[model samples]
Target: MADIADPRAVEVSRSATGALASLSLAMLLSSLSTSIANVALPTLSEAFSASFPAVQWVVLAYLLAITALIVSVGRLGDLVGRRLLLVAGLALFSAASLAAAVAPTLPLLIAARAAQGLGAAVMMALTIAFVGDTVAKERTGSAMGLLGTMSAIGTALGPSLGGVLIASFGWRSIFLVNAALGIAAMLAARRFLPPGEAGQDRGATRENARFDMLGTVLLALTLAAYALAMTLARGRFGGLNVALLGMAVLGAGLFLHAEGKIASPLVKPALFRDPVLAPSLAMNALVSTVMMATLVVGPFFLSRALGLSEALVGAVLSIGPVVSALCGVVAGRIVDRWGASAMVAAGLALMAVGCAALAVLPALCGVAGYAAAIVILTPGYQLFQAANNTAVTADVGKGQRGVVSGVLSLSRNLGLITGTAAMGAVFAFAVGTKDIAGAAPEAVAGGMRFTFAVAAGLVVAAVAIAAAGGLRKRRSA
Candidate 1:
């Protein structure tokens, strides 16, 4: 079971188109499941006669499962077989969706959702890795961008589609629809995706590769603890939150220690030392943090500061995803034409400008101002995403692509959590109040300005990091 000369760099084959389509659907299903369930929370609450906090687990369970096991499953795919595992994941997801649709109780539904998330973890982790195996080297950025477009579309479509389904059918219809889509995705993946190159199929890789079960357990616990601390705080940090944070810290230390001892580590400590991978991952986190700020801060600014109606507020918030969806493919082409390195720097710069615009324009204009800033910001994000993903994943070896993609995804998710909790605190602090709901319009507007000012700084920091990494590489060369 010798490795392919360059397993990760392949020419486009006849099946490449279908493989990309299967991968796109996997990305869509994973992302769509994330947001679609949010719109159903209230309905779930009423159906189960439960409190909001309890029903929130319907979302949390899915999220936590992915956060915890995404990396482990990715590494598992590397060991077992990406094609075989991803196919299994789709089947599991479809089955779990059906179980969720028919769940007789709240706890059972939550369990089903958690199982579904586990399946999604495998799909999400492997989809991007497959891009390198299927697409040509020169067109990698375009493929990454296509996946980005699918993800954005899924996120944008989830709430609207979920609402329609809930209105026409029942709360159960959403999960039922997912079941059908999952089946379709499974069939496509099985039929279209090419078999793994020489060693990647469950031959020598399976026989020789070691899955770090201990490291995986420790990481999953740590991530779960950290995620719970973030979500459960609800803007109010209590003793439980503190304890959870402590647990996360302890778990991280243990995970690191275990990783240092592993033969085939889940995440190689050396990967972060690589100039391209480290900076790209760091930028991904920093950029994601700034982006999440828009979500956390946008609703308050729109409703409180701009005095927009709820309908208007929803529409305004929708602008970001719409822009992101539209720009994803365009960004990929730019990355392909210009190269990933240049696009990464360019993307970060645009985002910085967008942040500054958000800080000032809304204070001067109105909803138009906010929309304009988002227009600038969203394209930058898409550019950064496509370029960054292409840059880091373009050169990974056959054995490491799955875990590398997983780590990339992990960084983005962590950044989202950080932005939500920490940046939200910054916004609250700027508003000069803990209860943002009660803040004056002027104060809220001021908060918007202050928050974006901070977001701009974060983007600037990302630029600096990227520049520094590039300089170091050139100096060493």
Candidate 2:
């Protein structure tokens, strides 16, 4: 693929709409499975008789696999053919989900989950690359907004839908549904997308086109170390903290060294040359961290503090994604008028305010106070997310799209892990010091308040990064 300064410079067929929808649907399914499983986790653990630390691996496996493979798999797509990769990914994802639906033991289940992550990586790597092929550059924001909206909807609805399914059917229903969705996406992708070579190169040198093997190993090692260290630091492995920490250091050093020498690096060092990409990536990661933390911590608060039923708790938690979806729908139009940076800054401001309000739930005026704060926060976060994605995607040419998207996606995943782990640590520390066991309502409130405040601080830092990084000069709206 050649670097077209303007993706819109090429003529796009009207039929590409079908391709976009198919691709977006695949993305939605992939994101939906993640959140759906989040709610179904407790049920799965209870049914399987798994310990908390062990069950955490179920989620961690998928995330870690996806994080590690996205960039490398994406580069593969660039080498093979986007359509071929998409079909393969969808097939793998469906097969893995079926395996997950039938697994009888923890190891089988974990293996199945890891397979799903690999499938997801393929799907993720190819989906966005296909988007670049299907849509015009000028309309990328709008198209990405549609994708973002669908993702938000899937994310928001996943938990409630999973809860209902778990209540009516068994926990396996979640994986079964993913299989069904995957099958559907596979069929749709074949029918709608034109068959072609996915990762073809028209360039001069084979050396430049070779996969960044060292970089891939480094990336995998880096994420593994981080995940392992977090697990150890949580005291899951009573004596492995020092070893885990050492692994983290070693992995970081290897990743940096590999990134520098690779001709076709997973993370192109040139991306950092753009003043905006680095900070934008930071903001993306931090915001996701906050979102994940809140998502994880909120359930405990609603269940233990407010005494809400699981169904009601899911409904309340769903509000943000719902609003965020709506905001994403509108954000594209807003970005067209206001520019990407303004939208980003505004969205961050909204998230900050929303987080602050949620952090102070104990001080709310009435029963509806928490709900209102959620409504406020969700829309902003979603809008900011959509705008930020569009900006990052547009920052580079077609050749760089997959890699950029992969790294950006990786950052967000890392953020989610960090936020969840850190907040869990905070809540655990708070509860450990409390007089009551299982945490009193007041103690729950205090813990949540502290976490939300910390989340708010992170968002504020994102805002400052956006402002200080010369974004104002670029987006003058």
Candidate 3:
């Protein structure tokens, strides 16, 4: 075990290995639940005799719930206690999975999914928060990297796993699988994770411990509005989208106002003022947006532009996540050895190179080029995630870890929602067609190049921000 050299850091309440396993399972379960149901959308539609849009809610409900509640749940964990809440969250996720599996109606399934997402929100937030408790500060990157790897494995394994499960035991098997995993995670967490009382902020008192529920509600509503604005429109922003965006803007104003007045705010707006955190959040959002673009663009490019079959497209597309899973642990070790700030810069620089390569190389060299670019880009992403998460969380006070982790996760989720609409729109516009599925191969190729060129620019901006933040830290020091 790494030495606990930092005065504030302590050995875990139980075995670190056991705690890590529980946390890893939590991360995997949340991520797996996100993507697993997507492959079953068609089956759900047929089973429920529902329209495609209606069945789509099975996926969207979970995402929407997780997006809306992630930050608030994190803050809640801080006020109440992360360990107990994490256990409860695991139980809720497990029960909800079973509910979803047994739901006879489409609406019931959606409700179960939303509940499952609520539990996932807790899991996603607290798992990261618990890292400081479970590992030495010196090894934060490795723990962060391990979580990232589990996340990548879950994401990469989801569709393929779901496909296999569905073929063997029908659509219900997917939810059932998560149910089993959630049970195991809960048991391990109950046995191994430290208690909620142990990790509370040093100076905190019950008098000041009241949760800012109003602020949480306001933020959740505002985020839900903004997320809906980005998601519901798909590639097109119509009247509903504009109205939701307006609501989001108005809600943000109200939330800011409410937070200023609340005795215990859900998030201290002042936290964003920290040099390391401010840029880290922005960088996370920007990098997440670029990463999401690869998912948005890859399938269309592989199938339409390169004329690959669906099976081949799936196989090729899996490469990115596979790279991410393989690289996450190694990247974390590098961060521990080298330092987060430098690794952050190196990772962003590598991502920039990868994105640029993707823009040009794929168009010129096809599958080999696409594969090569993904190999570079995915590791860079893992490196950035491990370093960025380590940097952001390490700088925060212990009491704030849950809330900060939530906010960081929130930024990434928002970026993903934004990328789904914005990047996809960019690709569509570049291709010069509203009907992307019907567009010619050449148009698709040109679109892929242009879209990733934009992504590369985003990464360059992130690199500049990271450099600036590092400079600011030195001057402040």
What are the candidates' C-alpha RMSDs? 4.6, 5.2, 3.2
- How close to the true structure is residue 341 of candidate 3, measured as C-alpha lDDT? 92
lDDT of 2 by residue, 241-304 (tens): 5576687789878777777775666666666666767888899988988887767778777778
Pairs that clash in candidate 1 = none
Q: Give a tens-digit lDDT track for model 1, residues 241-309.
A: 999999999999888887777566777778878989999889999999999999999999999998999
Clashes of each: 0, 8, 0
| Candidate 1 lDDT score relative to the true structure | 0.91
Quote the RMSD, in angstroms, for model 2. 5.2
Can you give the TM-score per candidate against the true fold? 0.95, 0.87, 0.96
> TM-score for model 3?
0.96
Model 1 TM-score?
0.95
Evaluated at residue 97, the lDDT of candidate 2 is: 97
Candidate 3: stretches off by over 4 Å: 1-14, 196-205
How many steric overlaps does candidate 3 have?
Answer: 0
